[model samples]
Structures are given as C-alpha cells and as structure tokens.
Target: MALSIRQKRVRRISGDPVDGVVVQGPVDGLATGTPLYSVAVQGTIDGRTTCRPRGWRFGTWNVGTLTGRSLEVVEELQRRMVDVAALQEVRWKGEGTRFVGAKGGRYKLWWKGDDGTGGVGVMVREELLEQ
Candidate 1:
C-alpha cells in the first residue's frame, strides 16, 4: 500500500532525537497498532520523493512430517527466497528452536507439538532474526 504524507507532517510525527523518521499512525486498510517507520534515502529527484520497496515473502505448506526432511524444507524455502513459512503436521514432540541448512541459506525452525503425531512449525530466515 502507498501512503502519501506531506513533508511537514513527516517532520512533525518523527519527533525522535535520532536521525531517521518514526512513522506511527493509522495506516489505511491495516490493523490498528501496526508499527511503521521511515528511513532517509540518499538521493531524490527535485520534485519527486523515492520510496524503497520493502515487504516479506510468506508461504504455508503441509509437510506431513518433518522427521528427516527438515533440511530439504529449509533448502526449498531458501531457493524460493521465502522469508517466512508456516508448516503443518510436523509430527515432532516438544517445542524448541532448531537451526537448519548451511551457511548463506540458514534458517531457524520453531516447532510445537504434544506427541509425535501432529504439530505446527514456523521457519524464518536467519538474517531476519536480528531484525
């Protein structure tokens, strides 16, 4: 979605003593209390403002069982450039975080299950962990 705000309004809302702009307000078509921020760009045209495109790629899949194909899942997600993924029927016991895949394609898998029958999991790219 695109949001149009005046330069003066941007300055007023971003009252932080820091350098970047802190955009906090009701975004149209978005849920209430959604967080937003703005980063200063290096270059811009005389009469036009530049907007950097930023978004997350999410996906969902029913893997039946994650018993021994966790690495394969991670590799596939990486190949597709998926930032986050939700998995069903993980068939794993307990709940914890596991790091899978090799360097440059690493991912963190978080799973929760009562027995070894049905479970759910979420995998996130390792780089996104710091953010």
Candidate 2:
C-alpha cells in the first residue's frame, strides 16, 4: 500500500517540562522513509517563555529477533550529521569502547541502562555539542 500524508498541529495547554508526544502529521508528501516531523514547543517554565525546536525522523526496519547486527546499523547512522543518537537492541561486552570504536570514537556515550537486554542508549557528538 502507498503511504499517506498527514499533518497535525499541537498546542500546549499546560507547562510540562518533559513530554514524549508525536506531532500530528507528516511534513512532506512522502511517508515511506524518514518522514520528517518538525516540532516547535513554546511554554513558560518559571515565568519565562522558552522555545524548543525538535525534529523527529521516523524509519522502519524489519530486523528480526537476534538478527541483523548493531555495528552495521551504527555505521549507517553515522552517515547522518546527527547530533545525538538514541540506540536500541544493542549488545556489547566488556567496556563500551568496543561500541565506541565501532562509531569511530566520534561519539561519547552515556549508557543509561546496561542490562545487556537491548535498551535505550544515548550517543552524543563532541563537536556538535560544543557548539
């Protein structure tokens, strides 16, 4: 089936600092790969109106359980000028250097959860972050 185009506008009512909500619609006419969604969130945390810009790009993968490799995926992810990465289904032994090495040591990671059960991981680029 062909993908559909969707556009949605969301207005914030309350002052919530943390949120994980998806914007209503797709920005471009295509929705098959990397549907780009832009978000502009403005609110007052402490009587100060702050505007935060965020972009969420969505991709679909059919990697089966215990199939496909994390290293290869990381390589592909590196191609993008991504400031940060949220990785999942990653497994590494010993120090995380091995994985960092896989990313060409271009990133420093903070492993929030290391249960070895494929959870969320954050990778940040030093150069982009310093800017």
Q: Residue by residue across 1-131, what tens digits does model 1's lDDT show?
A: 46654222343334333323334322221112222333343223454555443445566778889999998888777765667778889999999998999988898999999979989999999999989
The TM-score between candidate 1 and the true structure equals 0.61
The best candidate by lDDT is 1
Model 1 lDDT, residue 92, Cα: 95
What are the C-alpha RMSDs, in order, of all predicted structures? 9.5, 6.9
Off by over 4 Å in 1: 1-50
Worst 10 residues of 1 by lDDT: 26-35
lDDT of each candidate versus the true structure: 0.67, 0.46
Top TM-score hit: 1
TM-score to true structure, per model: 0.61, 0.43
